[model samples]
Target: MSNRSIGLDGPLYDYLLEHSLREPEILAELRAETANLPEANMQIAPEQGQFMALLARLMGARRYLEIGTFTGYSALAIALALPEDGTVVTLDKSAQWTTTARRYWERAGVSGRIRLELGEAGNTLQALEAEGETSRFDLAFIDADKTGYPDYFEHCLRLVRAGGLILVDNTLWHGSVADPDDTREDTRAIRAFNDALHHDERIDLSLAPIGDGLTLARRR
Candidate 1:
């Protein structure tokens, strides 16, 4: 049976975001800018951002990778948690979307910390691997196209160090993963990925019912 559970609703999610997330002035501005975007819902909740930041800090992550940078919210969150010398490599295919991301990243004063790679995510990952980046990253977050999730997972597994963490977003696919009737390609892909990871010995995995669901895999 599927292990996914119901996620946050109106009051609780709002309360959590309000209480736990402390957005800096620049980040607030970035959020406002992102609010008008068509894919604004793709932005991670403020609480989720705080969670990622805390995880990065706890793991002492210096080198980070993000497969999808919508408006740079998650990247900024993780960047804020990193030390002075830390850096993040963020990838996205759309120059149009990344324009917004670049602006926010610059506004957050984290442009220096982030290297935005504009192109196909798979090719970028392959290039990074070829550049001797395999097993070098400290943390990786995959939140791009749902259909490319498995590829992203494989590449991230290769790029993240043995003890690194891989955070896969939208693992629940908005409750579709549990409904056998809903066999859309995206849901099927996520289901396959989740099943494969559940039995994989390379990582210690846990699927949390956070916003849309987040799968945390710590490389073993």
Candidate 2:
């Protein structure tokens, strides 16, 4: 796939991170600590975190849901930006990884605002559905397993209220979505998700060329 998006490369990426992203010291430390982790790629960029925070504020979101916690960076970002009464339910099955996430959440003093649910994402989502959680979330972020994106989207759509926002990460699949030669399962799944989203009439969608591609779907 062609990397048509104007992303900062090597030196430029570092330069932007240093000069533009004024990340807090604690957040920076957390990012550094997880830099070598197997799922380090799951951490959202500082710019992306800032954007999500802004969206949360702009939407006046009080009840949020996140499909993946990943060391709690994004959850922390959103919590910090939300109102005092706001709450976030973050899902991830890894207790090992979430140990780090919980540490940071407590350190940030946002532990009360976040609930860490450890289990298969689909099962947790299904449970939420069974609990009659439809239209209860003001905002939802999906960035978990790629193969399950479609399921996540469907559930999140039901969970988020009308006019709420659902943000899907990695829609571009590192440029693989546009590559005809790429037949990997993750890439194919992402392609199918994108195609379905393009025609889906339930939401107003825009596939932004943000970090790894982010799709914003505002429920109608």
Q: Which regions of candidate 2 are displaced past 4 Å?
A: 1-7, 11-15
Provide the lDDT at 142 for model 1: 97
lDDT of 2: 0.90
TM-score of each: 0.94, 0.93
Q: Which lDDT tens digits does candidate 1 get at residues 1-220?
A: 6665545679977887777778877777777888897878888767677788889999999999999998888888899899989999999988988888788788778889899999999999999999999998999999999889888999999999999999999998888999999989899999998999999999999998777888999999
Error of 2 at 151 (Å): 0.8
What residue pairs are clashing in model 1? none
- Residues 1-220 of candidate 2 have per-residue lDDT tens digits of 7757567689988887677776777788888888889868888888888788889999999999999988888888888888989999999988998999899989988899999999999999999999999999999999988989999999999999999999999998888988999999999999999999999999999998778899999999
